[model samples]
Target: MEYQYCETDPFKRPTHLLEANPRGMVPAIREGDWASGESAVILEYLEDRDRDATHKVPLLPTDPRLKANCRLWIDHINAKIVPSYFNLLRATDRTNQSEGIDRLQIEIRALVQAADERGPYFLGADVCLVDIHFAPFVLRLPRMLSQHRHWSDPIPGTRWHMWIEALERNPHIMATTSSSELYLETFDLFMNSRLANGES
Candidate 1:
């Protein structure tokens, strides 16, 4: 199987394999004429292919509760943590900073607890799609955290520190993704523009 990863922001890239599937995003994968889009959907489809497929970590678990817990954490991170990070990025004035930081701290605390609830990994020793779903964002978190003075303490105090450790130690995780320096450059430009424009 061949995977085509579009690394640009979807708005910047415009056209993607998602045009074929209409899932409102990239990170699309094509197998012959078949295509799938949207990170979550593409990940699920790929996971279904085989138990041993390496594109993603295994998702199925022997215990139904563990599976449910994995899915629950995935959803919680997407709904809570992701948005709070964006809020932090887009924060402009002091008010934005205050509210964004508050939300971010709460979400980060919850995420840390959820992540620690299992052990070594989101699902213990072996990683899973839950880990993958959050990997891209987590991989970028350190750089993002560096941009904010407020994040310095929370990052290491929370599961975010563990995330950095995992991603760095695991060669298979986002090994094909761009260098940290590039992400830093673009993120700085993005934050600078957002700050200057009073965007939130």
Candidate 2:
């Protein structure tokens, strides 16, 4: 299937998208007559579609237990980790921001422990749904943390750094990530504009 990219601005969304997804959030997909919203659901839809097509390498594991585990982690990352990271980023007050960072660090450590059990990727040797779900945020994390002047090395010798390093080498991840320079520039402008509006 051919993919078409639509750049959306949350502050001023396009009418067609608003019709498809009233919430106006991004990462939505439209497959012919069917349209769906939310990242996790979209990932599942793509994975199921590919599996049905008998793709050479299915994104989800074949084993039922392993597939369930992948879904669990994906939910955790979306529901817990991503929100904490965003809270830290948008916080205008120093104290609240610091607390938010601390919470994020705790969440990261938990994620590290989870990934360490499987090694390399969240689901053993191969990149799976968990990795795909979290990759976009993980790619942006180092820069986002640094921009706040609250950067610190992930506890020395932990899988936190190793996991990030391994992810950097993954072909799929590399294809998805923006250049650090571009990400930093865009993020700076976004934060500044949001701050100017007294948003948190």
Candidate 3:
């Protein structure tokens, strides 16, 4: 499948995008006359559309119960984990920052404990929707936490470390990910702006 890039600046949203998706989100996709917004919806569309085809790996499992579990974890990450991480990054004051960090640590531990019994990826050996949804945020961890504080090992133990290692090794993730240095530079700019605005 081919995709066209439509660069969206949240500060200067284009009219075409507003027409396609009133929400003005960057990841909104338009296929022929069909259009969908939100990362979860867009990912589901892609997965469902290609499910019958044998050429590509299915994003969600074929088993109904497992598929439901994947969706649930994806929702958890989107609703709880990612927001907390963003809050931690955007926090300007030490009190708020500490609180954010604590919240994120709890979330991370829960995620780690929920890892599949079989191995690596969230759901056994396959890189499912949960991995896809969480990868963007987790990829930033190395640079984001390292630069901020002395507590380097936020996610301890070999299991989490191996999981992260597997994610970094995945070709799709590597292709989509920005360089750590570049991500850190952009993150620092965003954090500085948040500090200026006195936003927690």
C-alpha local distance difference test of each model: 0.68, 0.75, 0.77
Task: In model 3, state the lDDT of residue 136.
Answer: 81
Candidate 1: minimum summed lDDT over ten consecutive residues — where?
Answer: 149-158
**Steric overlap count per candidate:** 0, 0, 0
In model 3, the runs with Cα more than 4 Å from the true position are 5-8, 14-20, 149-151, 154-157, 192-200
> 2 or 3, which is superior by lDDT?
3
RMSD of each: 3.7, 2.7, 2.8
Model 1 lDDT per residue over 1-200, tens place: 45554565543445554554565455676677887666677777777776675654466565889888878878887898788888777776768877887887787667666775544467667777777777776666666665663555334534556655776577767566578787877677777666677764
Task: Give the Å shift of residue 162 in candidate 2.
Answer: 1.8
Clashing pairs in 2: none
Off by over 4 Å in 1: 17-24, 52-57, 116-118, 148-150, 153-160, 188-200
- lDDT for each residue of candidate 3 in 64-162, tens digit (9 for 90 to 100): 998888888888898899898888876666788788888987887788778786558898788989899988877887767657732245444467777
Question: Which residue pairs overlap in candidate 3's backbone?
Answer: none
- Write one digit per residue (lDDT tens) for candidate 2, span 9-86: 555667868765778777677777788878888888887776757535677888898788778878889888999988
Q: What is the TM-score of each candidate against the true structure?
A: 0.77, 0.83, 0.83
Superposition error at 21 for model 2 (Å): 2.7
